[model samples]
Target: MSSADAFQQLVEETLLANAAVVALVNNRVYEAPPPKGARVFPDVTFGPADSDDADADCIDGVEHVLQLDVWAQDYGRLSSAKRIADAIRKALHRADLALPDPYALALIEVASIRAFQDPDGLTAHAVISVRSIIETET
Candidate 1:
């Protein structure tokens, strides 16, 4: 699998297996935002990702900047989304995680998190960014 694909898979698995995250989203973590009609609140979806080559000294690698969005609806607040975002951060930040056999995760960390209400008036969204470096296993 491509590095980005493997990275997402690693993240999705890590989130799904986390009790706190599962309790909040209940397997609602998706690689992409689900269709609008099928979306459930308090979910985490993979957002935009930027991957750039990190090759050096003949070693192949990638620096990946990825985002996970937390969705919730609490007309008066963003607390729920915030909580989910925290859980996601805890589950991933500085955590040692395994990738597919072809790849090795060199580092993973939470970059930043932002919470806000969508213009729709009822949707609260939290965006969590994660950065990681991955290298192919020889």
Candidate 2:
């Protein structure tokens, strides 16, 4: 599996998990570097997945898999990685879904949360990977 594949899968899972949240918010938003208050965030985009990569199946014989890659712009400056993961989990659980086993989807792992000092000051980014397998009842 490549980074792009992993990233797309994570994206799909997150959307599914937070369908309700998305509907309520009216727009998608990522946590951005705070200058205290900024009405609009800078233009940011999630690049497309690599052309050659493809999605993968779950080891437990799951048919469908959903994966998500979430990150803040200024990574590794502030914020706790675990807290970010918890936030992602909460977002997912709110829609009545749960993340799958980590071992099943091994792509971009949440190694750590770090802070970077920009010219403006210090900023934080929380990169997270989440997955959910589509299980069938036998």
Candidate 3:
């Protein structure tokens, strides 16, 4: 399967399988449609924790960072963190995308997911983080 397609599938399956994520409380996963308007920040920078390797290149050329502005209408951080991480890990590992080393994969961070409620229903805005090395040749 294609990388994007695998990413979507991984998100769905991993979240569904999470034990902490109960069905009744937070069952559904909402995603923005294709060509999501948010700007993707490619070539994100990373540095070693304690090393001053300013010249060290942790990632190869054109590191990719895809930002999809998604709404989790029913789930909260307590139930979604593990699932989200799993989804990212699985998707990044899929053959379609460059295979990132398992050790290199890390949870960068997650922004505060605020509850967004309206007449339609309730939702939350989340900024999911993922760390990956650009294994593909430039």
Candidate 4:
């Protein structure tokens, strides 16, 4: 699998295996936001998938920026969304992620996090940005 794919798999697996994340989202983690008809509140979804070369003098690597959207109902504040975001941050920030062969986690850290009321008016959304540098054997 491509490094990006392997990295993403590792991320999803990590989230799924995290007790706090699983409890917060009830394991409702998805690659992307599910259709409106398939809505499940208090869920997590991937924002996008992108990668760039992170080649050093002696090592070949890839840098991936992952965005996770944590969702909850906006009853007035972002309390629920914030809790979910915290859970995810604890799960991934500086995590010891294990990628498949040819892809090893060189660095993993959580970047910015934002919580807001979505345009839909009833949804509170938290956007968490996680950056990872994956060293590769090539």
| Top lDDT hit | 1
Q: Write the per-residue lDDT of candidate 3 for residues 41-109, one digit (tens) a residue.
A: 111111111111112365332223334333443433323433443343443333233233322222222
Q: Which lDDT tens digits does candidate 2 get at residues 1-138?
A: 433344455554564446443443223343332354553222111322223223345333232223233333334444433344455456643244333333233332222323233455433333333333333222
Shift of residue 16 alpha carbon in model 1, Å: 0.3
lDDT (10s digit) by residue, model 4, range 98-132: 87787789998888899999877788999999899
The TM-score of candidate 2 is: 0.32
Q: Please give the lDDT score for candidate 4.
A: 0.87
In model 2, pairs of residues that clash are 9-67, 10-67, 10-68, 11-67, 11-68, 76-114, 76-115, 77-114, 77-115, 77-116
lDDT of 1 by residue, 1-138 (tens): 799999988999999999999999999988766787877787888899999988878678999999999999889389999999999999999997988778989899999999999998999999999999999855
Candidate 2 lDDT score relative to the true structure? 0.37
Return the clash pairs for model 3, or none.
none
Between prediction 2 and prediction 3, which has the larger TM-score? 3
User: What TM-score, to 2 decimals, does candidate 4 have?
Assistant: 0.94
Of 2 and 4, the candidate ahead on lDDT is 4
**Using TM-score as the measure, what is the rank order of every candidate, best first?**
4, 1, 3, 2
RMSD of each: 1.5, 9.2, 10.7, 1.2
